[model samples]
Target: MPKLKVLNLFRIQLSLLPSSLGHLINLQTLCLDYSKIEDFAIIGKLKRLKVLSLQHSDIKELTTEISQLTQLRLLDLSNCGRLEVIAPNVISKLSQLEDLYVQLCPIQWNVEVLEELKGLSKLTRLELDIKDSKMLPQGFFSKELRRYNISIGDWPARINGDESLRTLQFKVNSTISLEEFQGIKNVEFLLFANVENGLDELQSNITPLFNEKV
Candidate 1:
């Protein structure tokens, strides 16, 4: 029998994939999204697999074996509700990785994880949806970052000192100061949603900051 090279097993209502899937060594893209898949060890045997998407699945933890697929480029786990831990060493081995979307995942954000990712030079885009503002990682606003999108339960007490950031999209409730816009010379787009402060106050505070730049 010929080997299956691609599979879109998403939304199949399956909690576990049959071990038979391991036979498809040539598989590249495997999407098990919206399925109740909580076990990932079955597909760990596929050495050539890449582009794994487990978004919206019930997966609680990512196995270390995920690093075996060195060719993986995009890994999306946007809504894995029970997810709590991410093995940093497993993720650091993916040298070719570019896009990582972990929004709504319950992974505990920590300073160590953020520092580790700084070594992932291939990462240029990041999206985070965290429920706790205190859980946010520091140095995430560094100049090396190109794009950032964050949705937190509360606005950060401070937003400034990022030099290379070009785009910033945030949903918060805290007041934004005019000084926060200084030193951000490349910012061309800014999106603030669900803010408690009035738009007029925000505009008044920001208009002067951008008058010379805009």
Candidate 2:
């Protein structure tokens, strides 16, 4: 009989767990949010991990061993204020990953990182709330992105041109020009948060824009 891993505790406050968590080779899901975990080396060893949520944690950085979890499908590190780096190679190995949310995390949105994410053909949804918009590569929109939520300092020159995007949520102060929405078709959801009068002109032209309630 295969062994069953047991890790069930809610809202426990611990600065860091012993490295012994690596022993749970059968661990498939791990949720350590609202905890005092300042480091993430212990969870890196769970080779079978698929779902990991570290929201609102005080973690400073992610270990390179995070790439070892090749089977990971969903990873949420939202609101990790101290996180500064995300290893490119580690992100590249997550070929099977489907959903990724890194909102409010300080990750360098660079060209290489964008290229690596584009390589992950399986990623369907991505939510990134970044402080700087210039760091995002021009080709970041090339991959088969289905849903995207981004906070940019300034809108990109253009969105993905070749493929069809389903949804786009942009948190910007400026209005999006009609040219930027050229290649996009059949978009079910479109959100422009914290905008000024930029959307007034578009509101009359953009056909069937999603409701504000959505």
Candidate 3:
């Protein structure tokens, strides 16, 4: 398996990878989505890895060594409700990160939780479970990130409608009026979650009703 560069264990029984997996020096993509893996520390040795998808796994914590993969571009942790922690500055360490998806993360719920994202200057897409909209630091959304998904617990005063945004998902837990989305436009995919408004009323506020997603 010296030439093996891609590994896709969609649903394997192997919960933990052997430390010798580091020998895959040329490996570039690793897909471990929907596995029972509880730990993810050995894969960091893949210096050439560019894509890693660990969506919907039992992984509760990531080792500090995860930040060592500076070449990583995409990391999907969606539906990982049990994921509890990421080493401080772990996100910031992935200098080449472009698409970062973190949904329902049960880790620290504070203002600084989003602070690590600011350092990923190359980010192009971001999905976050925003528990406290007020805690969001200034410029939490980068103009460079064309795709965004944010679940807000509280109504935010200002939401950036970047002209470059290709997809925007505004998941509000509060019963806010849909009229607030009148400013959003020209997005390929737009989603509204948990809005306590009727379909007719919700459509009246948003101009492009045809582009609604979920």
Please say which candidate is ahead in TM-score: 1 or 3: 3
Work out the TM-score per prediction: 0.70, 0.72, 0.72
Off-target runs (Cα >4 Å) in candidate 1 are 135-138, 143-148, 152-167, 170-188, 191-214
Residue-wise lDDT of candidate 2 within 72-151, one digit each (tens)?
99998887777878866888988889999887777666657666776887898887665554455554544556776655
Cα miss at 145, model 2 (Å)?
3.5
- Candidate 1, residue 191: Cα displacement in angstroms equals 4.6
> What is the C-alpha lDDT profile of model 3 across 83-193, one tens digit per residue?
877767677789999999886676655557578787788997877766554565655543445677655553343244454556565654333334334334445555665
lDDT of 2 at 10: 43
Worst lDDT run of 10 residues, candidate 2, spans: 154-163
Candidate achieving higher lDDT, 2 or 3: 3
C-alpha lDDT values of all predictions = 0.68, 0.67, 0.71
- What lDDT score goes with residue 125 in model 2? 80
TM-score of 2: 0.72
lDDT of 1 by residue, 41-99 (tens): 87677788778898888888778878787888778888788999887677777767777
